[model samples]
Target: MDHLETWEQKGYVQFPGFLSETETNDLKEWVEQISSWPPDPEKWMHHFEQIGPIARPARTEYIIDFHDGLRRLLTTGKVPETAGSLLGQPVVLYKEKINYKYPGGGGYAAHQDAPAYEFVKLHITCSIAIHDATPENGCLYFAPELHREGLIHLNDQGCIEESKAKSLNWEPIPMKAGDALFFSSYAPHYSPSNQTDQSRRTLYLTYNALAEGDLRESYYADKRQAFADAEKTGDQRMRVSKIGHFNGKPPEQS
Candidate 1:
């Protein structure tokens, strides 16, 4: 089946080596630079951690707002074309971020992307592999076509409940450098903890219908304010976005 067909059938599509080797190398260089950026409390670059049954160190994240290469990658690059083809319409960028899951980094909870993006009704995301992602190192697994059901019961963590998630059929998506995975915002997806010693960094670029109007700037502005307010109240964790939530307890191994 063609890409659009795959998207229609799976609620997600994978484009392997969409970028040429040279382009991929260049992007890797850019990732190196971006990853080295110094942390600033005034900026949105941040880290999170977890410990318990799943132990992990801080995972890093930063919004892509002003990077020229990154902007070009999402706008004039293959990301939008791939996403637009799946969407059957022109798509404009909504937001982008890199989840730098280092060794021992905990996994995200199973959650749909739509609920976190309230500024727009429809959104699609493209995840570009910056490094090889293996099941041993936190590659994403998706519940195929469950997105057609829309939002499901959310647990206290603001993610899909454990019981419902257990009922869905999830398939793992392992990727090599330069591979891209596109999925609807409603798709239920999650990644496992990075058990390997290496890092697994993926750049997630989200877009909405061009007709929805570009809300990227305002969206980040609002997030900055929201997080800033949350910081002031000593309750930041509760207000943090659900992008990386771990849906429920890990299933017991028999």
Candidate 2:
């Protein structure tokens, strides 16, 4: 079976070493560059959280306005095309982020991406491994076949409830530095906290069908405003379920 079939059946397809080492290295360099880029509240939003007793930073909702390398990587570099093929339609960019889960960073609770992202009709995210992912360093764990049921039972925090998640068989997916994992928005998945000293960074690019009309600008605009609103009202919790996993402390260190 081809990738399209695999995606349709398994909810995702893991393309290990899909990117060359050189390409992966290039992306790492971009991660460094973007990390250093002043986190201006107006342009992009980043999060700094406490991991155990240490504070670590990660960037999300970063705009691709002036970043030539990332622009090429997302558009001309075949990410959108690959996602389009898997989706059985031509797709457009929806959202992008570099999840640099630093050491001691907390793990995400079991959840599906669809319910959290309701603005769009369809969503598919491509996770490109910027560093080797292992169970020890918080690699992704996916629940196969649950995506077919659509969105599952959600908890107060918007994550899949433990009662519901317990019924599904979970599997840890490990990838090399240059691999990519493409999963549907409804796919049930989560990750553990990074135990190793090294950080677990992944570049995630989400896309929607071409017919959906480009909503990238609108999406980010809404997020920026919502974030400001959250701050003003002190709804300071990570409203987005994706990053909400990085809450207070990483499970009380000994």
User: What lDDT does the true structure give each of the candidates?
Assistant: 0.76, 0.80
Best of the candidates, lDDT: 2
- lDDT digits (tens) for residues 76-98 of candidate 1: 85779878878988899888777
Provide the RMSD of all predictions against the true structure, rounded to 1 decimal.
5.0, 3.0
Q: Which regions of candidate 2 deviate over 4 angstroms? A: 52-54, 239-243, 248-254
Cα deviation in Å at residue 147, candidate 2?
A: 1.8
Off by over 4 Å in 1: 41-44, 48-65, 236-254
Q: How much is 131 displaced in model 1, in angstroms?
A: 0.9
RMSD of 1: 5.0
Q: Residue 96 of model 1: what lDDT?
A: 77
Write candidate 2's Cα lDDT for 1-254 as tens digits: 88777888889899988899899999999888887777687776666666656556655565587588898888764789889988888888888888778887777788888865656887799999999999999999998766678768887777788898888899899999999999998999988888899989988899998888888888787777777777688664664433354443422224
